[model samples]
Structures are given as structure tokens and as C-alpha cells.
Target: MKTAIYEKAGKITVAEIEKPSLQAKDDVIIKVVRACVCGSDLWRYDENVPHEHGDANSGHEAIGIVEEVGEDITTLVPGDFVIVPFTHGCGHCDACRTGFDGTCDNHPGYQNFGNNYQSQYIRFHYGNWALVKVPGQPSDYSEGMIKSLLTLADVMPTGYHAARVADVKPGDKIVVIGDGAVGQCAVIAAKMRGASQIIMMSRHADRQQMALESGATAVVAERGEEGIAKVREILGGGADAALECVGTEASIDQALGVLHNGGRIGFVGVPHYSNHALGSTFSTNIIIGGGAASVTTYVKDFLLDAVLKGQINPGRVFTQTYSLDNIDQAYKDMANRKTIKAMVTVD
Candidate 1:
């Protein structure tokens, strides 16, 4: 089997390794069809950590066909197409049954599916928890729909999670920080939430255009005080809610700075630095919320209908794609900002 290994910061390589086999009664094997690099992957890249040769299974965003399943895996079988949410969960657990799939109690908490999914075949533990069956067979949709389903594994649902947590509502002014894949989805998510005005803070020319295509009413290409001023000026005061999709002290401050006194702010970016404005949150009545999104449980709400109806193009955020052999290049391009998001066709 071909697998992607996080050998160290700034390096991802394809290596042949032992193929995964069922280790648990509910385990399943997926022939990964499509997988992509995530923004969080860059944290390891930037830290420049020298992970020893062939050390870690790093990717989680993927969708594929079930190649094999344990006898206990009743919800899925060989040939079933499924979306592997970044946050895998026990579908039948109380938290997952409700909607808090991120807090699923039956699986390893907060960690992704064990191996790097950017591979030819990967073992998925607790097949039922890790796999969300596609509404129909893979052939049932257009090529673009398949790409849309890939985003449901993580970025799309994550973006929608920010909106849901912030309680974005109709006619409210909304601002989204960061122009990465999730932030772009935040633009679409806020629009889906019925926000009257969608404001995006982005500097990348290509991503700015994607934001517009995703339904952002306005895009700000400035930063620091200048950018905040521009967005506030556009809003004529402050926004009703802001989604902090970039996990940085600076981005967090910007999100807080551009909100109305009693507004809401939801953040989904994996935190890099502590939010620097705890005082502002204390004084202002900003309703702060957001954590990892439960894509496994909430996919139907944010991605399924939209993809099935062809109403949204979350896949457009995948500006480029590569074969599994080029997994290294895929990660490099995404890490260097040469691509909005990179997808790999694993098969």
C-alpha cells in the first residue's frame, strides 16, 4: 500500500508500507479515493519538527469506498462510499446521536483516524464511527458533487460549525477572518445562515475571488488596524457576528475588534496563540463560541443537501489536485500558500 508519512517539518513523502487489516471487530478498510491537505497540517510544517523517518500518520480529510469491513460493521459494507469526517465518532453514542459528534465518547478523543488517509488504502477503526455513508452510490452524482462530498469530511462542516456556534441569523452583519478553505466555507456558511451582509477579510487575490463566488458580499484585503477600519467602515459600525477561522492572536483580536458590542463570534481555527483580547470579551457582551465541528453528525445540515442539489461549490476551494504519488507536492503547495487547498486522488 502507498501511504503518506509526516517524516518531518517541510517534508511529506510517499512510501510503500504494510496494508492495514482488521484489528477490531468493527474496523474497516477504505480504498481512499480522494484526500486533501488541511490548514492544521501546516502547524507541523511550520514548527519545523524533525519527525524521524516515517514517523506519523498525519492526514484525516478524505472520502472513499469501503474495501472491507468487520462482521460487526452493519452500517457499511464493501463497496459502500463514505465520507470520513476529520473528527471520527461513534455514531450511536449519546453525544453523536444528538449532534455533538466532536465530543463522541466511544472513540479516541480529538485525534484523527490513526493513519494518514492520503494513501492508497487505510484502515479506519470503528467503521461505523469513522464513515458517513454517502446518500447514494458514487456514480449517482456529477464529478463536482464528489469533490463537494470531500469537503464535508472537514472544512465545509467546520465552517458551518462556526456559524452555528455563533448563532448567526438573518439580516445580521457577518465578518469572516482568514481566507483559507474553512474561511471560504465560512462565507458560504454565513450566507446559508441567512446573514444579510457577509464580510470577508482576505489578502490573497485568488482566495478573494473564491470568497465572492461563495457569496461573500464584501472582501477586505487589508490587515491590522487598516483592515479592521476598512471592515468597520464597510459595516458602518460593527458586525453582528464574526468567524475567526485563523487561529492566531492577531486574527482573534481582529474578530473581536470588528463586532458590535453585543455581537457573536465563533472560531474554528486550531488555536496557534492565545486570543489576546480576554479583556474585550469580558467588557463587551460578545457571544463567543466555537470548537471542532461535528461534521460526522451535522453533514446533512451543511453539506448533503447543498451537494445533492448542486446549490453550492465547496469543492472550488480545492484549487488544485494531485495523484497520491505527488502527495509531497500537494502538502508543499498548500503549506507555501501557492494553493487555496490541495486535493489528492488516492486511487
Candidate 2:
């Protein structure tokens, strides 16, 4: 099997690796059908980041057909199509019970699947609690459509998680900082939740257009203090909720500055220690929350329904697609910002 490996900082390669086999009772073997490069993956590829060490499997968002299942797995079987959730967690863990699967302590070893770690334990969730059954579909749906839904495995649900954390409500005015796929997905999710006005803060024309199509009522192409002022000007004061999808100090400050008193900010972007100020957030009385999205929690039910109903089209974010062997180009395009999201076809 050829897997994308992060050989070291600033390096990536497609290498022939042993295929993963079923090793746990709850595990299932999936033949990768589609996968995409994530923003976090890019950070890990950076040589400057200390934690970006070691060779690891490069993707977490993927969909595939189940080739085999462990003995105790009764609900899924071979040939079942499924989406791989980004976070693996034990179903019965207290954190998972509370809908915080990303923090699950008992999650099995799928993490090792990507890394060159020799430990037998899966580094991430390989089978215990990170996979979801892709909704069975009618033959009428096109392959492109199915591939589009796979985006929900991470970005879409992640955006939705931002909204959930902010407690977006019907008739509330929402502002989103960042125009990445996650931000666009946040726009759509806010609309679905009944936000009366959705404002997208972005500097890129292409991303601004995408934000509009995704359900943003307006777009602001400003940065720093100016952007925050624009958001308040449009909302008549401040937005009821703000979502920060770009994990940068500027974006986080912009999201926080535009929120009305007592409002909340939900951040989905992976933050670095230097990028955010916890003390400031605490003093502002602004509620802050969000981390790795509990994608599996929503993957099977809410996300699948939204896609099947045609209410959300996250696939629009994928401006480019490549073959598995052309994975290098996919990363380059994303790194250069020449593409919004890049999809890699494994078949």
C-alpha cells in the first residue's frame, strides 16, 4: 500500500508501506477511496514546529470502503462505505459520553497509522471510535457528490463545531473570521441554525464569493482593527456570536473584538502558544471554547442529513483534485494558497 508519509519537517513522500490489518475487536480495515490535505497537516510539515517530528501518515479526513471487520463489530461489515472521523475515542468514555470525543483517553491507536512509530498501539484511532458509516446512498447520486460529503468528515463538521460552541441561535447575527473551508462551512452552518445575518470577514475575492454563496449576508475584506469595525458597523453594534477559523493572533483578536458584550467566540483553528492570549479573553467576559471537532459525533447524523438534504455543499471548497501519487502537488497548491482545499483520489 502506498501511504503519504511526513518523513520529517519540511518533507513528504509517497512510500510503499505495509497495509494495515485488523488488530482489535472493534476495528475495521478500510481501503482508502478519498482523502484531503488539512491545514494542520501543513503545520506539521513545517520544519520550525518542534512537535512536527517523525514520519506520520499525512491525512485524517478520508472515506473508504470497509474491506474487513473485527469479530466483535456487528453493526458494520465488509463493503460498507464509511467516513473516517478525525478524532478517535472510546464510545463509553466519560468524555465521549459528554460529546467531547477528541479528548477521549481510551481512544484506540489509529494515530500510529500515520506515524513511523514502532509501537504496536495505533497512534490515533484506527478502529475503536473514530469511524462513521457513510450514509447509504441511491445510485442517482454522482461520485462527485459522494466525494464532496467526505469534506464533512473534517472541515464541514469543524465549522459546525464552531457554531455549536458559540451557541449560535435563531435570529442571531453571526460573524466569521477567516475564509478558509472551515470558515465557509461555518457560514453555512450558521445559516442552518437560523442566524438572521451572516457576515464573513475575508480579504480574498474568491473566498468572499464563496462566503456569499455559502449563506453569508455580507463580506468584509479588511484586517485587524479595521475589520472589527466593519463587522460592528454592519451588525449595527456587534455580532451576537463570532467564529474564528484562522488560527492566527490577528484573526483571533479580530473575532474577539467584534463580539458584543456577553457574546461568545468559537475557534476551530489550531492555535499556537504564541498566537492567542488567554488572559485577555478571560478579562473580556467573552466565552471561549473549541478544539478538534468531535466529527464522529455529528458525522453519522447531523452532517449526513444536511448533505443528503442538499442544504450544504461543502464540496465547493475543493477547487483542485489530484491522484494519490500526485499528493506533492496537492500540498504545494494548498501551501501557496492557489487552492482552497485539495482532494486526493485514492482509487
Candidate 3:
């Protein structure tokens, strides 16, 4: 069992390690088929964020075949193909019932087993309630379909969360901050939710093009005040809603700058801002909402059908692919912005 290990900044080494197995009565072990490097993973690889060095579980999003199922797992079986969400919870919990599986009371803070998804196998907790079953095996779909299914594990659902929390409505105008995979998916989400005008803030041509193809009505290539000005100019004024996909002070400020005084902001970026940075929203009557996405709920409820029906192509964000052995290069490509997103094929 080989897994990615974070040695330090700019390095992700693959090493043979113990394969995971059922650790609890409700757990299942999955043989990973397709996985990818998430934008969030770069925090450690690029910024050298503090963590236990040599962490084996470096990646979190993956789609795989179920090789083993626990006794309590009735919804899935051996050989069932499934989408593995990063966070899940007991289906009956209040938070889970309300589509906030990330905040499940029974499995608080639950995420992919060991965050070791970029590997040959992983133990998935809450298997009975969380894993979303695909129609058939991985081989049943085209390469493009597989890539699209993989996005449901994290980025696509995350982007949808930004729009869902922001209350994007029909005929509404919305601006999306950040041009990463999540931002691209946010464009798709805003369009799907019936937003009439979708403004994507992106400086890269490749990203801007992708955003347009994903349904962004306009693109703002500037940053800071310049970017905000562009978005407002395109919208003819403040937007009805803003999606904050980049968890940074600049991105958050950019989201706030393009919205109307009483507009709403859906922030899904990993928080890296000062506590007081968001306090200013109080004076503007702006509504702030969003957190870890309800990946499980969205996938089961609608996204699965949307993907299967070919209504959206969120997989377009995966502009590059790598083998499991070349996982280090995958991280480098994403960290260097050479690829909008990196997809991994686990052999």
C-alpha cells in the first residue's frame, strides 16, 4: 500500500505503507480508483503550514470501488463503485438531516479516513450513511465522466455550497472570488441555481476561459480594489450575492466589495483571515454564511443525477492528470498553477 507523505514544503514523497482495513463496525475499506490534489493541499506544500511532518494522508478527495464492507453497512457492498466525500456523518443526526453532514453530532469533524485518499486503499467511516453509490463500476464510465464524478467528492459540492448559502436566486447577479477549481465550480453552481449574471474574478487566461465555459457571464482579472471595481462595473452596481471561494483576507474583502449593502456572501474557503476582518459586515447589513460543504447531501439529492444526465461538466477543471507514483509532481503542478486541478489515477 503506497501513500503520499508530506516531508516538507515543495515535497510529497510516496512510500509503501500498511493498507487500511475496517477499524469499526460501520467502516468500509475502498480501493481507490481516481483521486486528485485539492487546492487546500497546497497550504502545507507551498506555505509550509505547521503540521506533523511525514503525514501519510495528504489528499482528501477520491472515488473508488468498495472492496470490503462492514457488518453494519447495508447500502453498499463489495465491488460497489462510490464517491467518497471528505466529510460525513450519521444520517439521522440533526445536522445530517439538515444537510450539514460536516457538523454531524455523532461523528463531529468527520472527514475521509486518515485523509490518506491518494493511495491504493482507505478506510471509510460511516459507510452505511455517507458513501454515494454510482450506477456502475468505474470502468462503466468514460474518462471524462470519471473525472466529473471525482469532483463531486469535494470541489463541485463545495462550490455549490457557496451558492447554496449565499441564496443565489433566479435573475440574481452574483460574483465569485477566487479562480481555482472551486471557483470554477461555483460558476456552474450559480448558473444551475438560476443566477442570471455570474462574474468570476480570475487573472489567468486559462482559468478565465474555464470559468466562461462553466457559465461565468463575465471575468475580472484584477485583484483587490481593481477586481472589485471591475465586478461592480460589469454588474452595473453591487451584485445580489457573492461567493468567496478563496479563504484569504484579500479574497474575502473582494467578495464583500462587489455586493450590495444588504447582499449575502457564501464563504467556503478555508479560513485564514483575522477574526475581526468579517466584523465590518455588521455595519453593512451583509449576511455571511457557509462552512464545510454538505457533500453527502448534495451528491445524493441532485448532483449525481445532474452529472449522470450530462447537464454540467464540472470535470473540465481537471486540466491535468498524474499517476499515483507521480503524486509529488501533481502537487507541484497545482502549487505552481500549471494545472487548474490535478487528477490522479491510482493503479
Q: Top lDDT: which candidate number? A: 3
User: Model 1 residue 177 lDDT?
Assistant: 95
Best by TM-score: 3
Off by over 4 Å in 1: 92-94, 275-280
Q: Against the unseen true structure, what C-alpha lDDT does each candidate score?
A: 0.84, 0.76, 0.90
Models ranked on lDDT: 3, 1, 2
Clashes of 1: 0
Off by over 4 Å in 3: 275-279
lDDT of 3 by residue, 126-239 (tens): 789889999988888999999999999999999999999998999999999989999999999999999999998888999999999888998888888888788778889999
Could you list the CA RMSD of all candidates, in the order they appear? 1.8, 3.4, 1.3
Residues 164-227 of candidate 1 have per-residue lDDT tens digits of 8899998989999989999999998998889999988988889888999899999998888898
Candidate scoring better on TM-score of 1 and 3: 3
How high is each candidate's TM-score?
0.94, 0.90, 0.97
Counted clashes in each candidate structure: 0, 12, 0
lDDT, candidate 2, 38-123, per-residue tens = 87778866545554333465777877777787877766777777777667766677877877675575754433244321111122
